[model samples]
Each structure stands twice: as C-alpha cells, then as structure tokens.
Target chain A: MVNWQLYLLMFLPLAFVIVFNYVPMYGLLMAFQNFDPILGIWHSQWVGFQNFQQWFHNYQFWPLIKNTIALQLFGLVVGFPVPIILAIMLHEVANDKIRRFMQTVLYAPYFISTVVIVGMLFIFVDPQTGLVNHLIVSLGGKPIFFMASPRWFRPLYVFSGVWQGAGFGTILYLAALTGVSPDLLDAALIDGASRMRRIWHISLPTIRPIVIIMLIWSIGDIMAVGPDKAYLMQTPLNLSASQIIPTYVYETGLLNAQYSFGAVVGLFNSVINSVLLIIVNFIAKRLTETSIF
Target chain B: MEWIRKLPKRSTKGDMVFDIVNLGLLLIVCLIVLYPLYFVLIASFSDPTQVNLGHVWLWTRHFTLEGYKVLFATGSIWRGFVNSLLYCALSVAISVPLTIMAAYPLSRKDFVGRHVITVILTVTLLFSGGLIPTYMLVRSLGMVNTIWALILPGAVGAWNIIVARTFFQTSIPNELLEAAKMDGCSDIRFLIQIVIPLSKPMIAVMTLWVVVGQWNSYFPAMIYLNNTSLYPLQLVLYQILVQNQSSIGITSSPESMAAQQHLAELIQYTAIIVSTIPLLVLYPFLQKYFVKGVTVGSLKG
Candidate 1:
C-alpha cells in the first residue's frame, strides 16, 4: 500500500513551500515586467530585458558590484582561516578546563545580535568620545572618523564579522579534530615527533575535508553577503564602500517603490550566486572528491 | 590498564615550549574577545562625561545609573522586548512541528516521492527568488503588516529540514517502526510516542536554534511591519542604536544638545548590554546544545 500517512504528514510543509518559496520564484518573473503594485504580477506589462538593462547601465552598478565583491572577498580571505587555526590551537590545549573556558569566552560574541555589534562598533570607534580615539589621542595621533572614513569601512565590517563569527566557525573543525585517533597521536609522540609535527601530519589532515567544504560554501556565497550588518554600519560618508547589492535592492524596491528594477538587481545577484555555487562545487569535486552536492 | 591509558605522556622540552606558546596565544585571544564586552558594561555604568573623556576605562568612573534610567523610561524598548518574545515563541511553535513533520517522512526509506521532495527543498538552499520577489509575494498575501509576515514566510528552512531529516534517519531505526506497525500502532501514534519522545534532545536543540534566530532577526520585522507598535527588539535597537534616534522624546535645545549627545553615547552602551544580556545569560547553559546542533547538522546525509 502507498504510504498515504506520510503524504498527510508532508501536507502543511509542502503547502508552505508552494506558497512562500515557489510563489516567490514565480514572482521573479516581475524582473522582466514593469511590475506595478496596482496592476499586480499577472497584469503588469512585460518589458523584456529593459529592467536588467537599466540596472546594467545605472550609475551605481559598477560601484555596487565592486563593493559587494570586495567586502566578501576580504571577509573570506581573512575570516576563513582564523577558525581553523583557533580550533587547532584549542585542540592542542591538553588542559580541558582552560580550553573550555577559552572556547566559551570566544563563542560568546557570536550570540550578540548584528545590531548590537554594529552599535558597539559605532560607540567604540566614535572619534569625539570613543575609547579607540582616546587611545589614538594618547598615542599623539589624530582621531580618525573611522565610521565616516570609506577606507576603514571594509576593515571594520570584515574584522567585526571575524570577531563575532570565528569562534562559532571553529566548532566544526574542533569536532573534526576530536575525531582524530588519540592512539595515533600517542604513537607519533612516542616516535619523538614534535607537537607541531604531529598536528601538521595528524590534526590538520583530519580537518582538511571540512575546511575545503567550508571554503567552497563561502565562495558560493560571495555575492550573497547579508545586508543587515552592512546596512546598520553604513553612513552617508561610507556609502562608497558599503553600498552593496542587497542594500541597493532594499533602498530601491522597498523604500523607493521601484519594484521592477530592484527585482532585476536581486535576480541578477541570485543568478550569479547560483552559477558560482555550481561551478565551485564542480571544481571542488574534481580536485578533492568532496563537494556540497 | 585503565590507569596506564589515562597516564600523561612524556613531555619533552619541545612539547613544553609548544604547550606554553599555545596557552599564551589562547589567553590573548580570550582577552581580545572579552575586553570589548567588558568595556561596554563598565561604560554603561559610568558618567557620560567621564566616559566621553576616556576616564571610564578598566572600571566605572563617576559612576551613575542615568543611562539605565533613560533607557527604562522609554516605552519602546519594553514594547519591542514583548513583541520579540511573542514572535520567537510563535515561530518556534510553528517551525519545530513543521520541521519534524516534514523530516520524519523524508527519513523513511519506503516513503514515496521522498527524493523528489528532497530535491525541491534543497534547491531553495542553492537558489532563492531574492528579496524583492519574496517581499512582493508577502505583500500580495496580505501578510505585510501582520505577525504572520514575521513568523511564517521564513519558518521552515531547507537547512533545518535537512538537519532534522538527518537526525531522524540516523537516530530513529526502521526496526522500531516495523515493531510499532506489527503492534498495529498507527503512524501518527508511533511518531507521537516513539519518534518524538526519543528525539527530545534534537527537538530541544531545534527549538533553541529557532528561538535564537527569531529573536535576533530584525530584517523581516523591519521590512514587513511598518507599525511602530509591532517593532521587535532588534528593529527598535537599530533605530535607537544605529539611526541615533532618541526614542526618549527629549527635545533638544542648544545647551541640552551637548547633554543630549552625552546621554546618547551612554544610552548606546546601555542599550547594547540590555539587548544582548538575555542571550549572554543563557549562552553558557545552552552552549552544549548549540554545539550539538551544529555537529548534528554538519553530519553528511
């Protein structure tokens, strides 16, 4: 007998998917049309490729693309390896009490909301009345308007991201390291191999698969950097460095009511991300025989 | 044999050097993470003028609770807290059951069309319809200004379903289901009695994950709910903290503008602590489950 009971169980979730997920996919057709809220998706006039063309030719196009890619790439290069190193360091701490205490402290920041993190950034980096500027002044340097300066935006954004995320990111690597056989490590130690050599040969290779997987996933998400923290961190002065694609979509689509153009930009981002993911997955499978797929 | 296995290995000079270096580096890492959080706490309790003058470092100087007083005097923060709690509760209620319902079926080997359904769900992980279209869909559904907009649209995620499915597949054996079937027990009964009760740890992990996510989420609330009364904590936080809007309704005069600026800086510190304190408090107790959740999800199906 066919498992009708299973189908019954799947009913609500499938319905939710169809309505929330699938309908939005269908509404992506609005990227083609001159989507008017009054006329709705079905009745809107379809101007094939005009919206996309407008986004392509828009004054903000190159800058938006540049800022988005730069921020993500910067984040990936700096933020990716910290966790691996942290996990390895954490793994080496034979004292469980000290290791656990350190892990708890490090992981605490990850739980703080993005808004609070950004707020803390603004408070800490404020030139007139901030601790960082105080330190700068005491050192006989001028107080830099870190938030307003476009040069500092990417570093602040990426580093704060690293600060909040690196600890939590280590968990997977730590788990992988924990799986490394202790007997093998003891054998290596008895063989008079140094701690560094043992870690290099044993702990690092054990976690290599996870590291590659994380690398591939993060690469696939290059264009999909979340706009929440960046939006919070954006100032009028730092717009050059922080005006990324998702934030642009929010500004145009929701705030300004230019639905079609926003849809086109968003659609473009989604397409590029999907394409990148597929290509990266293919390359990873070829090189390491490990892929998200 | 057990004592021997537990005995410490011989530590050569090189090993001792490595241990010292590793511990020293970790201690620095811990300090870097701890200092900012500590600064925020001390600054919140310090006098704004002293804080502005950078005298509040290491501990409170010219200590006062003026920031907390101003913060508590504002009604928006309280309202936001309430709304956030309600949203989180509702979201956890809806999402956990939906995840379990969907995952249990997919985990079963004999379930028809599981592969097709799995592919459909997994596609969303790789490709989404992007923000505008999703927003349009929500608006069209008349959920724009409603609580449903926050709780419903993003409730069941592909990653969550995959995690739940993997848990069910690994933890719930087919033999138990067969035994339950032979006992003439219905599928629903088995799920309620056997699957759910056995999966309490996973459920708790899922619930905690959903609660944390829903509590921290401001984007959906920012976009969907235009009504100020409905604003969640994070959105309210964004306004007061980032936008620098004084919800305290202190009308600024030229003289008070300087005072206003001081209070604003102090309020920012207090607000960060107030908003994040709940998560930080529960974090120590919940850390183990959170770790478990990540490890469970990271396991390949």
Candidate 2:
C-alpha cells in the first residue's frame, strides 16, 4: 500500500533536499565556465579545464593543499580519540554528581561561538602579558609567541579543538557504551580479570562498531575546514603557516574576484574529500566489517 | 536514572580507592577546562592595564566595566544581537516542523522509499559542495543579504533529521498507531492528535540542537551578508576582536602602546562571555530534557 502519510512525508524532506542541497550542485558548472552575470550560466564562455589548470599552476596551490591536509590530519590525530578516552573515563567514574558536573563544564566550551573561541585564544596567549606567557615566565621558561609562531599554530588549533569538542563527542561514544552489557563486565570481573583487562577485552570490542562509523564520518570531512578561525588567526607573522585551502579560496575568488578559480579549487577539494571518504570506507569495511553505508 | 537505580551499589576496597583517585583526576580536568573561561569573565571587568599585566587571577583586579561600555556603545552591536536572535527564531520555526513530519514516516518500517531517503540524507551528511558552490546557489536564488538566506539554506540538517527519524522510529511503537487506527483516526489526525503529544522530549532536544546551531553560526552570515545590518553578533565581535587587532581602539595606552599591542585581546575574551551567555542561561533548564530525550531516542535505535 502507498501510505498517503508516507508519500507526504517523503515529498517534504525530499523537496527540501532538492531545492536546497541538490540544486546548488548545478552551480558547480560556474567553476568550468567564465561565469558572467549578464551572460548567465547557460551562455557563459565554456573555458573547459582552464579554471582547474589555473588553480593547479598557481604558486600557492601546493602550500594551501599541504596546510589544509596537515591541519586536518593534525586535528584528526588529536581530536578523534580524545572523546573516546574521555568517554571511557567518564563511564568508569561511579560518582554521578561529579561526572555530570564535569560533563557540563567540558561541554560548555562547545557552546561558545567560534569567533569567541578564537577571541579567547588571543586573550590567553599574548606573548607580552598574556596569562599563558605569564605562567611560562613564572615557571622559568621563555614566553612563546603562540599565535604568531608558525610552529605552534597546528598544536594550538588542534588542542583547542579537543577542548571544545571532546566533551560533546563523548555523548555518542557514551551512547555506544550503554550498549555494552553489564553482564559481560561482571563476568570478566568474576573471572578475576583486572579492570583494565575487562575494558580492553570486552568494553572496547563492543563499542568498536560505533567508533568505526564515526571515524569514517570524520575522514570524509577532512578537507571541509572553514576559513574563519584560521583566517582570524592569520597575521603577517603567521600567514605562511595559517593560510589553508578555504582561506585561499576566499581570498582568490570572493575578495579578489577570481570567481572561476575559487570554484575550481572548491571543486577540487570536494573531489579529493569524496575520494578520501570512499577509500576510507572501503578500508574500514574490509578491516573491521563496518561501514557508513 | 533508571539504570542508576538498577546498578549494584556494593563496592570492594580497591574500587573505593580507584573511585577516589578517579574523582580527583576528573575534578582537575574540569578545572583545566573551566579556568580560562573564569579568567575571561574576571578580566573583562578588570582594568585594561591590570589585565594586560596578567595581574588578575581567580578575581577581578582594578575592576572596571569599560569593555562592556565600549561594546554596548556601538549601535551596530545591538543590531547584530537582534539579527542573531531573529536568525535563530526563524530557523527553529521552519526546521522543527519539517523535521517532525519527515522523521515520523521514516521511523515507520513499512514506509516505502524510507531506505532510499535515508541513503540520500546520509550522503549529504558525509559530502557537501564545499561552501562556494552553495554560496553561488544562494546568490543565484537572490537570497544574498536577506535574512531568509541564513534561515532557508540550512533549514534541515541531515544529521539532525536522521537523529529525529531514529527517535521516532525507536520511541513510537507500531501497536500504538494500530490502536489509534482502530479508534478511526486519519494519518495527519493521528500525527497531530497523538504522535506530537507523545514526542515532546525529542522535539525539545531537536529544538535545542537547531537553535544552538543557528545562534552560534557566524561564517554564513559573514559570507552572505554584505549589509552590516544583517551581520550577526558573532560576526560583529569577530570584526572587533580580529580585523582591528586592538591597534586602533579608543583606549590605546600611550604609556603602554608597545605592551598593549594585545588590547583587543580583552574584547575577544569578553566576546566569548557575550556570545555564550544567552545559550548558557537557557541550558540548565533544558539539560534534563536534552540528555533524557536523546538517550531514550538513541538507545532504542
């Protein structure tokens, strides 16, 4: 039976996805043509692969790609696992009151606006008199130019990401943790297994599927970092290190009016990200018997 | 709470020791996460020089309200604040209903095309057009610099839609629908008259998720809004704390210009407090519903 309710339900979200998500995809052609407002998309000069070639041959192309992948990989290395570790730690804690309180404090940062997170970074790291520098000096170490230094940018960005995200990310893993049968934990304990062994042998294996699903999702997002936080952090001193693909796109396309070039770069990024996601999903399914699809 | 009530409470000596040690470590982690926020609050009220000197810790030193005074003195800041709230409100209004209608049917195992729709939504979750194409579409739609541009483009988050779908699928039993059908209810009627009333908690959680998303989003506003009037509060704060870099503030210290290169740093911290306060004020009351509702919705799925 074609449930009338089902058809109505399907049409609404589907209509939304079509109008908003899929329709925008047609705009990708602007990257190929010399898009002009008067000429319109259909009538614009189709420049073939010129836009992609321009992006490829640009002096800063490789550097931007390098920075984007580096920062994302750095984020993945630090950001992905902190939540899992935190969730395990949180699950083991018997005190509900304290655990809840800790959760609230940690999750609180996630709610703070990104502009504010970037802002707080400046407040805490002024090399002259910033709180972080003051502490370092007091501890008999030289103050670091955190925001300005190329060396420190990735670490600062990644650790701050962990601080904001680890708490909220715990909710997913914690949800998966709830599925770990208490009977298994008890049985392991009855067999004189240590707490660490019980966690390693039983709890870890049970939550493995959820972790794999989330890992696939994270790998898919590797190229999609927005330009805001990194752009905000950019100064003459740190532009070399801080500039990434998104910032480059914004500067070249929107700010400089190199619209075709920007679109080409964006399309390139999308292709790479999609390829990465598919490859990661294939490897995950092969290795772990789990996949996002 | 149900799970806690069911848990066995008796503990061994090692368990007691481990619990104490674990509590201490967790407390320290909590403090490490929260202290920077605490310092920002204190420094926002403190005199600029003392703040710059790093003299204040745990409490305000040479306290003043200059940052707030400067922040409020700008007519632009107030406009941005109102715009942010407007964006959040309109987004919630559109998103909540569409999500409810969409999620409820997908939750039904008998629904044709459910799996297909699920795959389509899941694809969007993993891969997108990467911003520029999306922006071009918005511009093409003539939504740029308009408030609807912000509200409409992101109305249905695929992840949230799926989550809501899972919530409905897991929470609402088919037997209940059968009972409602036996009582001679139509599809929309059963949805309006029974399902919505039963789905209050999931609705509330999704509301929080959507509202928080719209409220904190500044990048889209920066991209789509050329009009300063359309700029959200976070974007205005971004300009203040970032673009100027404290070099041109009215409060520039001749006595401390070299040392005060970081003057805008205070405003950045102050901005965090400003941007976060509205959501934080509402969070405690919603916290119970958020976890309880999401857990129930997710656990069953």
Full-model lDDT for every candidate: 0.88, 0.78
In the predicted model 2, the residue pairs found to clash are none
After TM-score superposition, what is the CA distance of residue B57 in candidate 2 from its true location, in Å?
Answer: 1.5
Q: Give the poorly placed runs of model 1, Cα more than 4 Å off.
A: A288-290, B1-9, B252-257
Q: Which candidate has the highest lDDT of all?
A: 1
- CAPRI category for model 1: medium
TM-score of each: 0.97, 0.90
I-RMSD for candidate 1: 2.8
Model 2's chain B TM-score?
0.85
Overall local distance difference test of candidate 1: 0.88
Could you give candidate 2's per-residue lDDT for residues A1-293 as a string of tens digits?
64787677667767888778776577778888997755667888899999988888989888888899999999998899988988888888766776787788777887877777877787688798788999999999999989889888899888888888888788878778878898987777677665566678987898897787677768777986888788878877887779998888887877787777788888788788778888887887787775655
Candidate 2 lDDT by residue in tens digits, B1-301:
3322223444345655555666677778788888888888898888767877778987998777767765665667778789888888888899998887788788887787788888888778556665666777788789999988888888876767777777777778889989988898777788888888988888888888888888887788888888987888878888876674432344545756653444455555566677789897788678777876555544433
Worst 10 residues of 2 chain A by lDDT: A189-198
What ranges in model 2 sit over 4 Å off? A9-12, A284-290, B1-17, B245-268, B292-301
Candidate 1, A47-160: lDDT as tens digits:
999998999999999999999999999999999999999999998887677788889999999889998899889888999988899999999999999999999999999999
Query: What does candidate 1 score on TM?
Result: 0.97
DockQ of each: 0.63, 0.47
